[model samples]
Target: MMKFLSFLLLGFAFLLTGCSEDANVIEVEHPEKVTVAFFEALYNEKNIEKAASACSPALARIIRHYRSPQAVARHMFNMSYDKVEIKPDDSGVKVREQFKNKAIITVYFDGYYQENRIKDVKRLSLIQQDNKWFIDKILKDPF
Candidate 1:
């Protein structure tokens, strides 16, 4: 009887662990993370609304106008990937510039498109409103 009770408790614990894993909401606590999450939602997860949540109202509207994640990725961002690894560029060449309520960050994308590898870099302008960072614009690539 004790063994059966222990097994049931273990099963319940496993169930709880699985439930927590299912709630995979991205965290956007910082500018770099927000940028990464935005691309991940758009490219890998293919979730347009989730991606747009990290953008300014104007930018979000522009993104939504594409109608689908694929359209947004292709026409709007000009990059599409089957799998992607996105990160902020930390090469010390150009450090992240943060002003009173605005910041500029550069992000790097290394991914595959149709089994071919591709890389791209983007400089993003961000603004803080109500203590939350929103992507205001995608600056022209400096590379």
Candidate 2:
């Protein structure tokens, strides 16, 4: 009876805690959405901390190292995404790419910095940690 009670209490505790990403900020589930939101927070809202929150620990460190959010925002102001492709795995529609903890999201964009008319593609490395996806790295590819 004591064992059953302990198990029941443990289950209840898990239910109460849930799986919230962060208590202070909005929770974004998908990797693609998180990437878009990160850039939006950085470029549009000019919130470096908020942008950093959407990234992995390493990327967050880089963002925090910047002098000011406004400066980073200014540098990225011209960038805009054309599309995002989330790599699909054998899991199908129900749990696409569920088997893999890490994913690469391809972001196609136009108008980056001084080159307003140029088109470019960037691959964002994302890792699922604590049941939340965070951007870990950004890789630029030649057009």
Candidate 3:
């Protein structure tokens, strides 16, 4: 009976470890993916530090200055959502505009705040350093 109880506890511990929040983090292997992950972490997960992890050092410092996900989302990004769905614009290769170590990606945000629907588009510039993509800046909206 003692051996069976120990085995059961060990199995439960493994299960708990597998269910940790870290498991839900998105792995950004590409420029567009990083842009999407940035907004998702900020708007959906409401995690400022996690969102800043996808940014360049300069941009991350700016984001961190806000100190809260809501502040970053509202002031920096100029939008807020209780829940959001982000997708890269799939227009074409010409639209994506990826170069050797730089890329410009456009993403769409569909979200809601207090039952009010909101939709916005953002253009992001990214740079690759040490083979990892980081968000460099958010371009001004043209429209």
Clash pairs for candidate 2: none
lDDT of 1 by residue, 1-143 (tens): 99999999999999999876544444465777788888888999888887888899999999889888999988866898999999897766432343767778888899999999999988899888877788999898786
Q: Rank the candidates by lDDT, best first.
A: 3, 1, 2
In candidate 3, what residue range of length 10 has the lowest lDDT sum? Answer: 20-29
What are the C-alpha RMSDs, in order, of all predicted structures? 5.0, 10.2, 3.1
Best by lDDT: 3
Off by over 4 Å in 3: 1-27, 94-98
True lDDT of residue 14, candidate 3: 90
- Candidate 3, residues 36-118, lDDT tens digits: the string is 88888888888887788888989989989999999998897788799988999887785334387889899998989999999
Clashes of each: 0, 0, 0
> In candidate 2, what residue range of length 10 has the lowest lDDT sum?
81-90
The TM-score ranking, best first, is: 3, 1, 2
Winning candidate number (TM-score): 3
lDDT head-to-head 1 vs 2, winner: 1
Give the poorly placed runs of model 1, Cα more than 4 Å off: 1-27, 92-97
